[model samples]
Every structure is written in C-alpha cells, then in structure tokens.
Target: MTQPGFLFTGTPLELTDGEAYHLRKYWKKGRQAHSIQSLAAFDVDVDLDALRTLVQLDCANCHLAHVASCCEGGFPFPPAAELLPVLDEHLDGIAALLPLDVIRHLLRKGLYERHLETAGHRTIGTFDGNCNFCIVEKNGPACMAHRYALQSDLNPMSVKPLSCLLYPLDLIYSEEDGRTLLTALTERTAAFSRWGPDYRLDYLCANVELRENLASADSPNIRENLPPDVFAPDSYRPAYVEGRQLLTELYGAPFYDELHTLIQGGRRP
Candidate 1:
C-alpha cells in the first residue's frame, strides 16, 4: 500500500553525479530546469546494443496502471497548478469523449491547491482509487491528461507529474557524490549474468531460447555467475530504440551519440 518513491529511498545509487543532482533538485523543487549531464558511468553494465533494445512500451501492457498509480511517496514532485487551467481551455470538446470517472477524477484532483503541509505525508498514491485520469472505454485505454496535453499547446512536463513520465525508470542517487543511475524496477541485471539467461531481459527475449544458468544469482551470496554476454539480438531493435530515447531524455543527446558510436563496431551476441 505504501508507494515508496525511488528517489526518496535515499540510497547510494548506480547513476552519475550530475544526473542524480538533477533528480534531487526535482525532489526539492517540483519543476526545475534540469541539467542533463552525466558525472560518470555507473549503471552501464550493458552496451549500446542492449541499451537500445529495451522499451517502455504502451501503458496498456505495462503493469504501472495497476501498480505505481503515481504513488511516489516522499517524492516532492507534485502536479503543476496551472495545468488544469491550460487543459480547461483545450479539453472542452475532448472531455465529452472520455469516461465519466476519468473526467470526474481529473476534476477532483485539480479542484484545489494540494500542499504537503495540509494533505500530510501520504505513503500511497494520491489517486490510485481509479487512477485519477484514466478513461477506459470500448476502444482501449486513453490518458485524459495526455490527450488534453496533445490538444493544448502546453508542455506535459510542465503539467504532469514526473513520476508519471518516468514510470518504471527510477533515477536513483548516491548520497556522498550525488551520482545518479537509471534502472527499471521491473527488471534487473544479474551479477555478471549470474542468473540463467540474463533474466533482466528474459521477458523481452522470451521467444529466443537462451541458455540457462547453473544457478540463480538472485541472492547476493551466489558465487558462480555466467559471463556477461551480449544477450541482445537483432529482434530486440524496437526496445533498443525506446531505451535509447529514455537515456537521451535523461542524459541529453550527446551522451546517446557517444554510446551509439561505441556500439557501431559491436558484435552480435
């Protein structure tokens, strides 16, 4: 029930110092002009090929709808107060097309200025009861806020919460150096491919018949792990591109270009 925020965990992260500082500033100030730069490479276990092959994918397939629900506890990233005002100007016609609860939840969430002092510390998400802004009809799922954002000329980053934008991808920070590393909570890298088939990417490579490990490296004490082989193949091209975008957004374009150059001479797994 407690939606503990990844940033609020206060752990020594696997990211670069600059990136971590950028996220920390976000926690301190709701909206900030982030300095998208890297301090060092801490979580770059996989190369550009593996990095490029990962994907965030559609929310319909993502468990985030039923999981996180924007409940980043202790994280100070709040929704912008001016978003609804901007949406109101654009969503007049779009509101009718959405589900009633979606419209109602959006109205309820944006009704007043919610402050941490008045609202108190909430461990769970503020609007997980029905997802605050999800409007599901016969035609599949649609995010009302995203729709309104698209119609309006407003920037979603200025309006929507960062937790929503950075779902699954947790930008963890280091305490001493303020380094930050990006990671997917849903997946994890084994200690040098200790787990059978590099399970961090198992779900993505389900179709491929990967080799099984002698034992699981899930535990810290596990000794024997597989070699860090390039698990990503040609089939995972889409995920690679998606993952690249997330990296680019977080680390800026230059970092991505440098990594891409390194992978150009990379060999197939």
Candidate 2:
C-alpha cells in the first residue's frame, strides 16, 4: 500500500506556567515598547484590526496577555471541546489533501541567519498537557506554536519574530527598531504575497488550501497549515505596564505599592 500521506512526524509539544511567565516578559519587552507610527512607516501596517488580532492571539496562547490569564494560544479564546467530535465527523471529507510538508519545513526554518544552527537545539519542550513554560494546564486541542484558536489571556496573535513567535502576524524588532517595539513585517509581506501585486486572490486561495488540508488530514491543528510560532516583543515591560494599569484601575495606587513590596521580595504575583 502507498505510504500514508501527511504523516505527523512532529513530536507533541506542551506548555507550563513558568515558561509562560518568561515568554510574556519577553514579549512585552519585545513588541509593545516601540511606537505604532514607526512600525507603520516601516511598512508594518499597524492596522488596528490586525494589531488587535495579534495581541489577542499571542496572549491567549502564551499567557503573555495578562497575569492570571489562561496559558495556551489558539483562536476562539475558549473553543468548545465539543468541536473535536464534530471535526471527527468530517474527517472523510478531507482525504485528498496534500501533505503540508512545505509549511512544516518553514516552521523549522530560522528567522535570523544563524537561528536554527544555534537555537535549533534548544526547545521550550512539553509538560503535562502544556509546554513546560505554559501557565494554563488544560487547553483545547491545538498547538501553542501555531494555533491561536482557544488561547485565553492578553492576546498578541500578531507578535511574530525571533524563532519563538509567529512571523507575519507576529512582528518584532527590525534592525531599525533597535531595542524597542516589534512590527509585523513578515505578516505584512505574507499578506502582500497573497493579496498584493496582482495576486488579490492569494489570500482566498490560501484559505481554500487550508480548508482542504484540514478536511484531508483529520487534524485541526493550525501549525499544519501556517508557519511556526515565534514572537519577541521589545520587552516584558509593556505587559507589566498594562498589568499595573489594570491593577491601578481596578484597585488603586495602593495596589501598586503592595506590588512594589512583593516585587522587591521577589514574588511573581
């Protein structure tokens, strides 16, 4: 018999709470520190819709959106587990789909010239139903590196760069931004590739191709169709600022005073 097409050779990935904390810290420092106007000047779009989606997506998946948020990245924030069974019912409708080997190959590619050569050996790894750095223990069926379907928390669906966040949708520092905000150069290029320069239908075509793949493969994982998830915001300071804002708004400056005490004491919360 012919070899089964689309063999899932990938090792399953998991997430953990500690990893989630670190990831969030990295993102805030990496993505949100820079000005949006500069990003737009650099062909980054900075469109509100895409930006919202990016934040929503990233935070939901990685728990970088906010403290006390869910630790997972996927769409629909809280996708119903019941969809899995429904998806199973349509598996037969998706048989002729081609294997997304190209997509997988891209996932393994390094953004920086020496990325894979160096960082390739290191991985966040998996844990009990999450990445070793995951904050949310239980999650719907999806991959943290690719899908943002069921992710909860402060979503940064568009924060892409380095080898950790999704590119294209997840923009990060270009040499121009130096040490500040991350932009969506990759995501914008992808969008332009699909819907720009006389290829207005490329986005639609990609969507169709993805749907066909989903039907053919019996899997609903997003990484199977898109690039890997790799994002690095300017720093975690943005997340901290946002968190501080939330605390201040909800509680008051006194809350921040207590937070200072806890931070001085080396407490995470």
Candidate 3:
C-alpha cells in the first residue's frame, strides 16, 4: 500500500500495513471508476461513499457554541509555490478587504516568503482557535475574504484558500494511482485508521447524530445560549448538495454535474 500525498499540508493519520491494505481495497472499490477531468487542469476521482453521506454545516454554531474545529490544529494550506500566484494576484485586494490587524500580519510576515520558512506549506494563522481572516462577532465568525468576494460580485472561493473553501471535502493525491481523490470524512471512512486527524467527523456539521443529539439535549447552556435553528435535523442535507457551490467553483459545473449524475446512479451527462 502506498502513502497518498495530501494536496494541502496537514497531518494525516499514519496507516499500519494491515490498515493500509484494507484502505486501498476499500478505496479501489468505493471510488468512482473514472476520473472527472476538472477545469483546474487535474483529474479528480470522487469517493462515491463519502459523496452520498448526509451532512449539515452550521458554521456559526460551530464557532459560537462548539469549537471551530476546522480552523485549528494546523489546518491545511497550499504549498508556497501554489500560494505565490494567489498572493500576487489577490493579496492587495484581500488585504484591503480584511481588518487592519490581519493586513499588518500579512505585511509583517511577507506571505510567500513566510510560508517557505515553514517548509513550503505553512498553515494559516489563527487567533483564539479561529482563522486570522475570521471576524468573530456576536453572531459568529465570518470569513473576511468570503465577504469581500461576495461584496465584489465574485465567487467566494475565488478569494479564499482552496483548502478553506473545500472544508471537510479533501483532495489528496494518490501516488500509487496517479490521480487526485476527492473525499469527505464520513462514518465508513472515519472507522478506518488510514484516513483522518481522527476528530474530523466529530463536529456538528459532519455528524448527523451529534447535531440531533445537541438539538434535543437537556443542557441549560445549549438551550439558553446556543442557536437552536443551527442544530435542527431539518438543516441537514447531503454532502454533495451542501458543497455544490465550492465543488463547482473548484472543479467547474461539468465536474459537479457528472458527480451529481454518478451519485444519482445515472450516466454522466
């Protein structure tokens, strides 16, 4: 079994020989047989199992009530080489959109050069378990870059980091298969030792049971403080549908259409 290279830098669970073997076997059978040729100039193989899983992403609830799990623990960032283009093209615009402190940090750190110092793939800076670009208000944390994109009438993903935009949907390069695998953390994948930070599926957004439990839990803090609507079971939707915008932005409409078709058990359009 081969160790797959993650597209972004983050600590992945190391697999033992037996675990790796089982993972490879499962992956071979579970992933789409053909790669979807993405507009990003890469072929992506979607995990059919992961795509079909139901999920609910209440980002505000995660930030205000629970921990912002995705924002911490060395959250993935693109390599410096890849980041250079983003910086060159959008750094000024992003800085203008963000707060003064964030802009100051960017200037002080020298962006691409700073990433190179941290082994070519440095995680984005976080303060108080939230992303630097995250503006924490009474409502919850909001991404400055995303707000900028929306205000500017551009796709939110256009200004945000690829890894940030994708969230639970991961893109990993399979060295053995020579193609990128697009997957999400689901119960079946979570059970395997080869696939995670181990807590990827523990969040309210990722786990339907957690959301349901939290919604109906008899805790005063939950009922009095937390937002009830965010954890409602009705808020849950299939991962494919919830992630449609980011997926289409990253891979193109055709890629999403093909994935939707595959998930629906229909021939690719």
Candidate of highest TM-score? 3
TM-score of every candidate:
0.45, 0.24, 0.71
lDDT of 2 by residue, 1-269 (tens): 53211100111111233433433454444346422333122222233323322221243333221222222331111112332343233222221121244234324641112113122333333333333223343332223322331232322222211123222222222232232232232233333221121211121111223323433533223323332231223221222233444335434686555544433333333
Candidate 3 per-residue lDDT, tens place, 11-45, comes to: 22234455455556656665345423332333443
RMSD in order of candidates: 12.0, 19.2, 5.4
Tens digits of per-residue lDDT for model 1 on 153-191? 755543444445553344454454555444333222222
What is each predicted model's overall lDDT from 0 to 1?
A: 0.39, 0.28, 0.56
Ranking, TM-score, top scorer first:
3, 1, 2
Clashes of each: 11, 63, 0
Worst 10 residues of 3 by lDDT: 5-14
